[model samples]
Target: MRPFIASPSNARRTRSREGFMTFSPRKTPTTSQAPQGSPMLEWTGERYLPWIKDAAIAYEHLHRYVLAARLAEGKRVLDLASGEGYGANILAAAALSVVGLEIDDAAVQHARKKYKRENLEFVTGSVTSIPLREEHSFDLAVCFEAIEHVEDREKLVSEAKRMLKPDGLLVVSTPNKDVYRHESAGENPFHVRELDFEEFRSLLRQFFKNTGFLGQRIYANSTVWQIGNAHDARIDEFVIARDTAEFEFATNDRRVPLYFIGLASDAALGKFPGSVLIDCSNELLRQIQEALAWRERQSADRAETIASLEKAVAWRQTQLEDSLEAIASLRRVAGELETGNADLTARLRDATHQLGLIHASRGWQLILRLRRIRNKLKALVTFRVPG
Candidate 1:
């Protein structure tokens, strides 16, 4: 039993406690729904944090593998849009200094807290507008999965080009939009546009030459599809894999998922006017025309060689015919000479036989005349003696 003797305030307080016991209030509001610039990054933090962290480690490991292959090593590097400095740590381990720039303050803070190195420094900045004052500052600049989020991709590329020294190296990686669109149904809201291989190349060729693509695993759970591009005195694209063995090129089909990885530098930009672009099909056609002309010249040279050979063959045939005619004429002359020799031999044999017959007849006649003269002389002598 409860005591009822109490004041109105005390009674009311007791009733409130009883009510509180009977019914619990809802939780206080949180900042979970706060507006952010990139929902993709937030969704990444929520749904893919564990996998992303793991992938980040894998990415660093792969970079080490590349470094082992002597693909890249340096004293200074710029990690553009560095999420949590995992890649920066990897570079700093081998490099003298690594400057990591990120737009996300939370990510920067996390990087500072989790990984601290003497050679690594984290800064908050945007890719399109770099906060650093120095021009052509770093030896290497690397950007991964950040280009698709930029509002002005061209400006971002220009800024990246501006940050590099004359021969500085730039490396970048992005998603394979074909795979993402087909697998995720184009649900990534932060992606302004899903770029196929051609589209991606077109965007990169503006600031880079020798551009290439690499396919990589983003979260390591999804299908492997990220691109890595490099920029230096000349633009290049690195092969993306655990081995970094294969490289991306123009012949790659868009139907198969692929990413753009490339290099860029001042020399590459200088050669950009001659480089290939998707929108500049006419320019490509012109290049094709030049190629065709070169081919025609080659064909013409081959034709001239063939014609010269044919002419030689024809001249040889003519010479052979003349030689054959001369041989036939000589054979005819030999036959005529043989016939003349046979006739002369026959005539000489006939004359010799006739001369022999004549000599024999004359000798016989002389013998007979001599015998008759001897008989006449004998008769005359006998008659004279008788008289």
Candidate 2:
């Protein structure tokens, strides 16, 4: 069974619940539900769209809202910069009334059309200057991942303070610049300003009398519990001790937190424990394995193609070598023929001179005269016989 919300009894505690928390993974809307021509908001690294099929992103974002549901129960909640309204929807499941305030008109329209509940409502308004008429109306103001997007961080916090009841609590979160600067791909274009741990705590402390900070980061751990049992359990994190070279129990995670969540209020804040939401479906690991398989297939195909090209190149080289050898042999035969022709021409020239000399000589001249006389006598005899 998938555990929903852990008990806040211990700072590090785990609990198992049946089906009380019903914040299930939302499915992608079909084309019939949202027609082909319908205009939907795009996720340009700015806002988290529910339709985006990334499990890590979903876990990072949905966990915050699900945790906020604990504080939102039976209170009038105001969700600041609620881009897609999913968070507000989560709060509405328990809150007396939930209002989502967004800066983008399109996002507001999209949220209004997509998520509908009697207790939940979405409005278009800036966090710095909310358009709500009454002040001190809400019991809790939740601003998750919106503190860094606006230019006036102070005013945004002040607005949340002004709109909150005298004992209202403001649960705000922002990217930890110290850790996020290295983790993220350069600077985030959408984030106008981001606050580190000190800056975030100081800013919230200035407005609220009581402030508590929490570090949010993703970690891999083994969970153990009694079978078919629901009970609050303690959490212990162990790390290798560098000096002793042995396992040591660490107080808190040593990893730098990617985000800092601040719970600020005028009243004394209650002790809240750390919580974890398990992706029971194991979606992230599955997707990563699938991606690795696809990349391996692509690499294999590329290797095969390269090998085929190499064979083709070798065959072409052999053909060229044979053609070159054949041409060389033909050239040698032509050279020999030229040499033979030269010798024959020289012999012919010498023979022609020799024959001319024979004709001009006395013996040759007498033989020619005798052959002419014989031919003339034969011709006369044949003519007389005929007469």
**By how many angstroms RMSD does model 2 differ from the true structure?**
11.1
- lDDT per residue (tens digit) for residues 1-387 in model 2: 001211222122221121011122223242123323435765444567666666777788899998899999999999998987889999999999999998778889888887889999999988888899989999999998877766678888999999999999999888888788777656554455778888998999889999998878877666665677656555545543344766565555565678888999999999988887777788888989989999999999999999999999999999999999999999999999999999999999999999999989999989989999999999999989955
For each of the candidates, the C-alpha root-mean-square deviation to the true structure, in angstroms, is 31.4, 11.1
Instruction: Pick the TM-score winner.
Output: 2
For all candidates in order, the CA lDDT equals: 0.58, 0.79
Each model's TM-score? 0.45, 0.72
Evaluate model 2: give its lDDT. 0.79
Q: After superposition, how far is residue 34 of candidate 2 from its true place, in Å?
A: 7.0
For model 1, state the Cα shift of residue 59 in Å.
Answer: 6.0
